[model samples]
Structures are given as C-alpha cells and as structure tokens.
Target: MPAGASTGLPLETDRLLLRPWRVSEAAIQRELWTERDPRVPARRRIDADGRPTVADFEEAISAAAVPSSTGLLAVELKADAAVVGYCGLVEGGPETEGEPELAYELLRRFWGLGYATEASWAVIDWARSSGHRRLWATVWAWNVESLRVLAKLGFAEVRSEQHPVHGTNRVTMKRL
Candidate 1:
C-alpha cells in the first residue's frame, strides 16, 4: 500500500485488479474523461479539443474520491496489467452528502465486458467493510450500460432530475 492510505488496499476480481493510483496513470485518467463517447455529454468533457486541459487533469487527480480512499482508482488487467480505466468511491454531490457514491469509466474499446460490475462490486464490498451503511450513484440518463451495471449490483432508482447538459440524470442507491 502507498503511504498515508490506511484502508487503501488492492481489490481483485476474475479479470481485474483495482488498485491504488499510480502517478504514471495520470495521462490515461485524462484520456478517459476527455475522450469523446456518445454516452458522455459534452459539457462534462470541459475541453474543446479531445484532450484534457491542465485544469481538468488536476481536478481529476489529487481530488478526494471516497471519504477515506483515493478518488479514482486505476483498474488494470490481471492478465497483462494494462490499464482499462477506473471505478471507485466518491463523497458525491450535495444531495448525497454523508453517503459514498460509486462511480466508474472504461475505455470504449473495453466496453461490453463485465469489468464495471466486477470492479464496482469489489469497491462496494470494501465500503461495506469500511462501515458505510449505503452506497449511491448518479448516472447520465443516456448511459444505458452504466445503468445496467448499477442495477446488476442492486442499485435501484432513488430519484431523477434534469441536468442542464445531460437531460435526465438519475440517482440510484443500494444498501450495504
């Protein structure tokens, strides 16, 4: 484990190893957020170009993800240790304060695989062991894959609201 991370530990699934952040993965982190995907709305991209700006990169890193863990984790392949993308806990927006939020993203090439569900389940277990009573997530309504992933993990619709950019945003939660 890295220094200063008390509960920070590695989580393994059938094909992934969800582990601590590596400074080297910063560029890949930037790619995941900045890359164009039909599922992600443009406003969330922040950069006019397909690449991340300096501010966007800084905000993604060095940000508090989970209350007690690193913000976004680097999910790599167990077979070759190649970084696929990220899935981790966050403190969440105002409506979800005091409840941890489950979040994830994968490279478009890695889509349609079961990685999200596997990695998210691992994180969910970690949160439960860490004593959280509930877990929450907010998804862009158009992100059907993520909705399926959350639902498979037992998250039910908590509410739905309009977003200036993403149309209908849905908040879902699951009890730990």
Candidate 2:
C-alpha cells in the first residue's frame, strides 16, 4: 500500500476481497477505467481515450478513500490477490437526495461471472447497516446487463430521463 492508501474495511465473499483503495493499486485502476472500452455495457464512466494519467487514478483512489465523501471499495479476487475493479455506494446527487447510490465496475475480462452481483450485495448490505434507507443507481437505457444486475440486487426502475450533457437517456433505479 502506498501513502494515503486505505487497507480498507475488511469485506469478503466466497472468492472476493472488498478492500479499500490502495496507492499500490493505482496502475491497475487506471487500466481498468481508462484502457477498457469506455462504451462497455456498464453504467460507470470510463475515460474514452484510454489515457488516464497516473494522477487521475490517484485522485480517484483518494476520493474513494475519503469516508465522508463516498466509500469506493476496490474489489480484489481473493484467489490471486488481483485487483479486479471497484464496488460501493456514492452519495446521491440532487436528483436522488436522501438516498445513497450503488455503483460497481469490473474489468472486462471478469464480466458475466457474477462478480458485480456478489460485490453489490456486500456494498448494499454495508450501506443499509450504515443507516441508509434507500440506494439508487442510474444506467444508460441501453445497458441491459446492468439493468439486470441492478434488478437482481433488488433495485427497481424508478424513472428515465435524458442527460443534459451526454444526450443519452438514463434509467434510474432504487432499492428500498
């Protein structure tokens, strides 16, 4: 772990280790978010150019480490100690005030393997225990697999609207 990197709250599943962001994991974080196809069927944002500078990833890890902000947990594969991606709850924006929003992203190679669903369950449980009564997420209307993942996690489609900047429509979901 690098300076300022969190060892993370210990969260585990049968095969995954949900740990805090570590400075040592910066390179992999950059690869996962920037090098992976930006338009991959997930709801999380990815830099389209595949050129996230080291500083960019560092900032992200820092933000995730700030507990008062929103907790972002690095999802590591326990089998090999590989940093696969991230899962956590982000504080909702004005549109979703009073709710925490669930978010997760995985390396493309790890998709469709139940990692997202499993990690989401852990994060949601954490949020619930932390006193959050609702969790929300926004997905691009076309991302069917993500919609399914949210649904499987007990999220229901609450509404849809066009993004003012991206021009893409998004479907919002919530768990109550």
Candidate 3:
C-alpha cells in the first residue's frame, strides 16, 4: 500500500497542496515544530519539546504518513513548494467518534493570509465527500483565531471539556 493509504484522501485547495507526510520533509518538519508556540504545542499526544530532535520529527512524520491512521497532511504552497504548515482530520474516540477532529497550523510568517481557512475548508470538503456525516474540533477556549476559523467552516460550539494535561478548557465545535 502507498504511504498514506490510511488517510484515503488526496485533497487540494486553491493555493495549497494537501498530502501525506514524507520522510524527505524531515528538516522542514523540524523547523516547524521548533517554531511552534510554547503554550499549546500543536495538540499532539507526544510532548514536542521533550523530543524536539531530528529523529523525533522523522518519526512523527512517518507515523502521520502511514495509511489508515489518523494523520496530518503536509501543506505546501503551490507557487513555491514551501511547506507552510499542516491541516487534517484527527481520529477521535467515543467522545468524538465518527467525527474526525479538524486541526491545522501555519508558520508564523504565513499567518493572516487566510491559509488556515483555505486548508481547513479543503479538509472539510474531503470529509464530506468521503461520507463523513459530521466533523468536529476542539480548541483552547482562549484561541480566538482558531475559533474564528472553525466558525467560518460552519462548526458550532457544541460543548467544552477540560484537558488533563493542558490544564485548560477546550471548546468543542461540530459541523454537520
């Protein structure tokens, strides 16, 4: 099977190309992780700073690129082929079952250009096409920008939950 067959989607947007992670992208991935906000850490199960070495980034990308797994897509710009960030559906359990959780991040320099909304919309469209009846996402209650993006994608605030580690309330949103 191909590397990202588990993801089962080859999605694209107007100015971005969304695809499975690649081993060759280790350097770029490392750079992005290094530059991530110190507070949130990009919402992965693993603690990024504790494992910020090159090898860790490699493993992360490899895991995300694997087929049939809840994975992250490498978002690259069409004009220059630079990896700006990532956006994709994360598999959720009983609390969010049957609804892939949407997530994304962009390099700080690339912010304010509407890339988040663009990439997110692409993922939503893909989910809709794949027969997913609903989609959901959780954001730090204080993250206004992300909430705006989710809202723009038609996700309404469904509820909020406390994160065990993050020590903050996460606002859950859903779209159907």
Tell me each candidate's TM-score. 0.83, 0.79, 0.80
**Best by TM-score, which number?**
1
Question: lDDT for every model?
Answer: 0.79, 0.74, 0.73
Query: How many backbone overlaps does candidate 3 show?
Result: 2
Instruction: Spell out the clash pairs found in candidate 3.
Output: 6-67, 6-68
lDDT of 2 at 129: 60
| Model 1, span 1-176: residue lDDT tens | 24575774677888998886665677777777655564466666745575466555656565634335525577999999999898888877776766779989998889898998999989998888777888999987888889999989999998998977658889998999
Model 2: lDDT equals 0.74
Give candidate 1 regions above 4 Å deviation.
Answer: 1-5, 38-43, 49-51, 54-67
| Candidate 2 residue pairs in clash (backbone atoms < 3 Å) | 8-20
**lDDT tens digits, residue span 1-176, model 2:** 24564434667889888878888788877777554444544443454554466777777777653453247788999999988898987777876765778888888888899999999988877766666777888777667777889888878767777765444545466554
- The clash count for each model shown is 1, 1, 2
**In terms of lDDT, which candidate is stronger, 1 or 3?**
1
